[model samples]
Target: MVEIRGGAATSLDDMVFEFLEYGEESSPESSFSSGDGCYDDDRDEERSFDVEESKAFWDEQMKLLQGTFYRTNSVESKIRQATKEVLKDAAYSSQCGCGRLRVEAGGGCRSCLRREVCNRLMNLGYDCAICKSKWRSSSSIPSGEHTYLEVVHRSNEKRGELRVVIELNFRAEFEMARASEEYNRLIGNLPEIFVGKTERLRGLIKILCSAAKRCMKEKNMHLGPWRKHKYMQAKWLGTCERSAPAPLPVGNAARPAKSKASMLTFDLSEAIPIPGLRRTAVEVGVI
Candidate 1:
């Protein structure tokens, strides 16, 4: 009888003599080898299934993301149009009190941009305000605060207060320094300036957060906690403070010019005569 180490030896295999087996009949070793082939086949099938399942998941995410972006309601459209107009006008004529450009990029005045958009929306008869959302650090996410413009619409009984968020640099918020191509493609579809209802924004956050997770998985990278869904949702949806948009105080139209006499403009020869001082007129001689 053969002795097996680290495993139980089968009695049937022990009793079956190799000399008794025919050429066509399988031996114990061959049978065990065949079982290994079946196991490999099953593993291959499982791997294929996982790959297809992952592809389907990303595909569905892309579809849902595009759908959410394309769909818009009246309130959102109105606010979007108004926001565009305000930004356009500001680009041509507005400069922040801080002397920064009114663009959304770095070195640009984000507060000025928000104030301008909010005030303009209010002028359009919308209840727009600058909202500051602050949250303490939790187990999942760190403490952080976000400031953005929001419009509150009091619809009829069926629809209560509708909150539409306006993010001037919406795309930048989700941009990752190192991300998969698929994730970049998803973010590419996002608007630089986002104007959408809270519900719509919530849907977008879910889609993007899922995409981010998938992206990290594909890249075999770790996703930062701040990029998670809860953090993103808290930026706009969480409870916070809201203040009505007020026009930035206009700087003085013109500062009065200080009066000063230039020394260069004063004529020394025209000085008033001092007492006991004789005026000397010298005649020029040409040699």
Candidate 2:
């Protein structure tokens, strides 16, 4: 009969004979020959190597994916923060003394008076008051003083280039001009002809807004070497339907075409500045 040594059958042939002869021998121990053991060792070593390689590759991939995700999140956060700050500054700059005065004909601050004049001008179809106003200043308003306008840039992986968006905020520079004693004295003399300080402030803001829009249009048109990739571009997508030519009436009778109400879009990427003012200090973020 075969005997188990160290919990293993010493010989496979002996173990089988012993089981057949005794008819009730104990179960044989699981053991391999030296050659078979060496073969298995090689296989296990190879499998272990493969597992390690797979683990390392997957770890690297995970790190890369995580890095990309975090970077995108970081960029978005910065854009949002910058946008909030710019909007706040713009709103603050746009604030005027109009709200402090009661709305009365010939009885309020110049700021209030301007709004009334603007309404009258709008009704009169003189939308280009900034260009035509007698009180419009000729001096170039230096930026970064009463206004903070900037362009923030982020890399577009898909486009393989930088994408730019603008942010603009301006304070009323004409406040002092309106509050000056000379201006007050002049208004007193020609109250009917002179627009208030508020109107003057509005005109300046309009000029700046116009300049900003022009800058954006120019940038989009040029796109600076990345135009081929369509990487940096700006557009003004209004919320009004495109005006189409009206069809001629079949008979002499015809209905008047409904006027399309256009709304301005406040998208920084497609910001439209008021048409004529030139901005001097436009900050751009580093990539």
User: Per-candidate TM vs. native?
Assistant: 0.71, 0.17
Candidate 1's residue-wise lDDT over 1-287, tens digit each? 11111101222122112111222211000111224454586667666776677667777888887667656666666666676667666656445745554443321577876787677778889888788888889999999999887888898778788888888777789999899877888787676667778887899899998888877876668889999999998898887688875657553334456877789877555666567766688897999
Against the reference, the lDDT scores of all candidates come to 0.69, 0.28
List where candidate 1 sits over 4 angstroms from the true fold: 1-51, 102-107, 249-287
The digit string of per-residue lDDT tens for model 2 on 143-181 reads 111111112233556633222121111112212232323
State the local distance difference test value for candidate 2: 0.28
Model 1, residue 223: displacement in angstroms? 1.3
Clashing pairs in 2: 110-197, 110-198, 111-198, 209-273, 209-274, 210-274, 210-275, 210-276, 211-277, 213-273
The top-ranked prediction according to lDDT is 1
RMSD of each: 23.1, 39.9
Clash pairs detected, candidate 1: none
